[model samples]
Target: MSDWIILSTALAGFDHAATKHKVLATRDYLARPEMFRGARPNIINLSRSYAYQSRGYYASLLAAARGQRVIPSVETIIDLSARKLYENAIPELEDALNKGLRGAEGEPLPSRLRVFFGTCIDPRLERFGRLLFDWFRAPVLELTLKQGDWVSISKVALLPFSKLDEKGRETLFQAMARYTARQWKDAKSRAPARYSFATLVDANEALPPSSIDSLKHWARIAARMGVSVEPITRKDLPRLANFDALFIRETTSISNHTYRFARRAQQEGMPVIDDPVSMIRCTNKVYLDELMASNGIPVPDTVMLIGPEDFQRAADQLGFPMVLKVPDSSFSRGVKKVASMAELKALASAWLHDSEVLIAQKFMPTSFDWRIGVLGGKPLFAVQYLMAKKHWQIVQHDTGGKPLEGGFKSFSLAQVPPLVLDTGLRAACSIGDGLYGVDLKETNDGVFVIEVNDNPNLEHGVEDAAEKDEVWTRLTNWFIERIAT
Candidate 1:
């Protein structure tokens, strides 16, 4: 099956003889993203006409919605069509301007810019050029009637498809053909699977839950399971329709791009882990507290820190030494242990600046916290995360700006205490059967549910060490079943 598609109007513009020859030459490797006159599930879209005024743009959007990887995605096409270059690129240009564009001899930039316009240039394009000069401390002149002039100033022109000459059109064709050929060659060599999956992993994240090697290991395991896994970053949001499923290996939060990707994947009917609803439900500690308490799940006594009024009664309601947490905190970043009334008032006031409400829970002291990995409503693996030295939590960021992490010891489901496993499973099942890590504290008193996290850590040597390859195989098998069904 052809994995690449070239969609263009064969009547005009790209219908020229040279352009037609170039497109037809790649016919064996590329087609029109259709199977027997029907649209295929997934294919790389290479269209010549994606202007907002063109029908191709609307068709491309529909194709993208149906899981085709449309080039210059619908969002990109729309954004470009809006022609808000200054609005879109201003944030970057402003910083660059403040730093000042450096000249050859390390001098400041010139004061004037020479500009040119093609036949189909829009007024917005010219205005964009003027705005650039206005922001960058320079003047610009539109060379509407002059050509073939050499100048020291930088030159820019708005060139549309209608103004592109035959040579320019042929150049575009050659570029498309080369790009298509390279994509096909790589696909042939790396992924021979019938379907492709994308794992949203942040390569630049300083402390990603899953390391790059773990992502690679997951890809290798997915390949063995007859699925190709490709690592994608937030920048790949426009191309989300390219894969059969999306596995967000990055941290999941309601206010971040990860949640957006999950939502888009679900809207497109593509199976996605760290599903949007799960992310929304799990990210808010206040919501989790209410959910567990309402469901009769054993959780530490919690009080919603509404304001100073609640603060006066908080210690009496929960305790003096309560754990104050911002609703949407993760990695123990926004959690604080308040040992006294003054401490509670100080920390609560500071945290309240960012969030409207805070959650105060009676601190549960334990040597180690148990994290049970739950997937598909079943217990997968268990780990004991010991508290950081001289710290009350598994992760502690010292005043020196260095992170101190607790040691972890993996345990099989059979080895986990029955009460601990039962409580973790109950709390996780309350949420969807998608992947989760239920944190709990087992003390001499009793086991209590702490929180259920979406997109739980599955590092190579940490969470999956006990299950070995079965961890990835089970996950891949679950994805296959979800996608197939």
Candidate 2:
């Protein structure tokens, strides 16, 4: 229910390390899974559990197994447990955050840069994100390279903000300073407005939340609304401080650059949509499930599965005709429907291999799922996402796993069902007073909150069908108000 930092030390049992810091021993955390089963906590597992099955190893493993956001995850432990796996295996985790070294000297480095989320600020670092696209799950690694080989790739402790000791607090601030040290002062001529903002987007994204044409439309409308809007991408991190606000049009995730941009914008006192808090709350379904329940919002019968041991529990609770999902998946990518234990086992094993915890929910078939867009703690617009033809979900996949989305019909606020609108508002309010798309299933039984999305799609036709230009104006106005405050 609250933020906690689990000490990596091996105490005899779970006891308070510092009453004020909410720090606990590793064994205590390992012993109590129920304490965190339905709570949203940013757990920093400081236990150095490199051994195959030591107390620290079990602490990290169990924390992840219980679906907590941990640093040295199971895969990290498995790799480190074996020299053949860990040695020479350059950690690709931190590669996304830091790359493109010109160094103190003007000499170029031997290694090339990568930019998978989007292009880098420096064109020389374009290849950096791709080089780290190896899907190494051990996140927040500190990488140092020499003339030939990488000198070191060490895991940095993910300390909870404002809850660290003096040493840990210093480390956190220094790391943040290093990340936010650079600044770009490129100037551009533009029309005058009360303030300026950058629309962060990715032209190369296959299924971006907003299209280039849409941003252009919003920009034209935004100009008349007393704010200058320009399009930028991951390449514009250094130049971000120039703007008064930031609107992220690309999909966001904790592990990617999108989150970094939001964090930086927030750090610089800029009003940002898909703020870091919203991204953290919206991206993970496991957290949403817990949040919805804690707030007494209606959701389908759900079960959290840590491993095969929880298989029987899911079957007994949700039974056949249940849905399985990877917590962090989006756009119906990691979701699947199972009718028997055989299917559940096959799919659960595959998804759990990559993710720490999974979800099994009672299937609620609906004609359409209502997407109520909430901004600044108020309803912006509403739309119905029709189920794909003869499919159970809004988006169905072909034999090759290609996504085919269903049709959507927008709605005026007056026309939306009271229960749907009320449920959507309640769900979004639980997350934060930011931009959210609350998905709810209005079935014959009743209305149930499906999920609250941070960056809900505001496409040209789909979202604007009912409100038209009102959507963009309201969105821009939200930014103007935030900037004024």
Candidate 3:
């Protein structure tokens, strides 16, 4: 069978004629497949590759493909395609197809057909070339190309590790090592005699004092490494530009001031730990569910309830013994366990009055849950949190309102079960490359994700004595390394 090559005229808008010629040239090469035995024959060129400098090439290809006199130059086509992809207000490609191939003023123009194909190694293309080989052979791609209309194409592949050639990889690693050494030297040189860190704490919010103490200790450690820390109020955001970094000690939801602080820090190019996007991902249960599910991570059965009707429907679908939770609340504030339809209705009605989005999850009756902390794409630590006696929730406390004895036990990375470690890594990756805490439930069958926290607390004395220092040391080193880079 003849191999197929798909090239997008708009993506290759720079030199339509040249790109078309190249495609045609490459297609002819594939016809004599024996010439290139090491690589696959399927080739795809995206918008970024052709947009570089292929104008005349694009015009000729567009003319031939559409069979019309109107030919769009490479620059114009690239601008249009880029605008469509990045702009929120722009309608989808399907909508454009419905509008027909006419000038914005209604003049008859060429009928454009969007092409999607798979291939390996286009030296002219940058990132897309690196992606081509893996994407073409990917099992998940099921795009059906139309005869003469645009089709959006997407594919799934593991995060590319070997994309950089040997030289590039070695150079990058050496550069990183040199940078770290230089930063450590600079930190030592700039070390303050008695520096302090100031983090902003909300007076109205009831945060655990241990959380604040943890921030203070981290700040002190940063000072030893030549950075000062301080705590400020929300009223002091204007003066926050003076600090190296601002840590929010309070429990922050999506709608809270912590998010605003993070946004401000981002705009000013200041390093903010627990970024706003991270907070948005962690606080919104709907986002968490979709992200984890799409990434093939196993999570408890969860359904988003948009309204009263949807709430009842979801409850019916999940059946009794379901968890109804507010999308943004934590510490079990707005979380309720409903065992029957009546309880579900009452709880849903009560919660709907205050929040627009709610989640109903099939309750996993597990005795223990695992909390895994991930930093820099690696699992830093893991702990098994067993529920209090006769308590279903892992966060529950004893009758005297104290953390139960032996309720929580820390585990080394080697001690965590293979299943929990695997699931935790998947969940962390799904949330993007960042520091996070993944909570997984050990059910009868296997481990399932319960929650993923962006700003996980790292108190000094929280874990086992042997592991606590290691956790703190690793975290501090990671933070310093990131800032230096």
**Model 3 lDDT on a 0 to 1 scale:** 0.52
lDDT for position 20 in model 1: 25
TM-score of each: 0.61, 0.68, 0.56
**Backbone clashes in model 1, listed as residue pairs:** none
Off by over 4 Å in 1: 1-195
Tens digit of lDDT per residue, candidate 2, span 283-369?
877767776776789999988776788899999988788999887788887888999999999999987776656889999988899
Candidate 2 ranges with C-alpha deviation above 4 Å: 1-194, 399-402
Candidate lDDT values, in order: 0.64, 0.68, 0.52
Q: How many clashing residue pairs are found in candidate 2?
A: 8
Tens-digit per-residue lDDT, 1-485, candidate 3: 22323333333223343222234342222122234343333332222122222322232223222221211222123222332211221233334333433233443222321111221112222233223322122111122223344433221221111233455334433433332233121111111211123466765654342366666676666666676667777787666666655556667654446666665554444556566657666765655775576567888887766566676677667888899887666655566788988888888888767654577999888777788888778887787767757778765543465544336778888888898998998888766566688989887777889888887655566543336656656666655564555
Tens digit per residue, CA lDDT, model 1, 356-464: 5677999888989999999898888899999998889999976487689889999877889999999999888877879999999998889999989998888988888
TM-score of 2: 0.68
Candidate 2 accuracy as lDDT: 0.68
Highest lDDT model number: 2
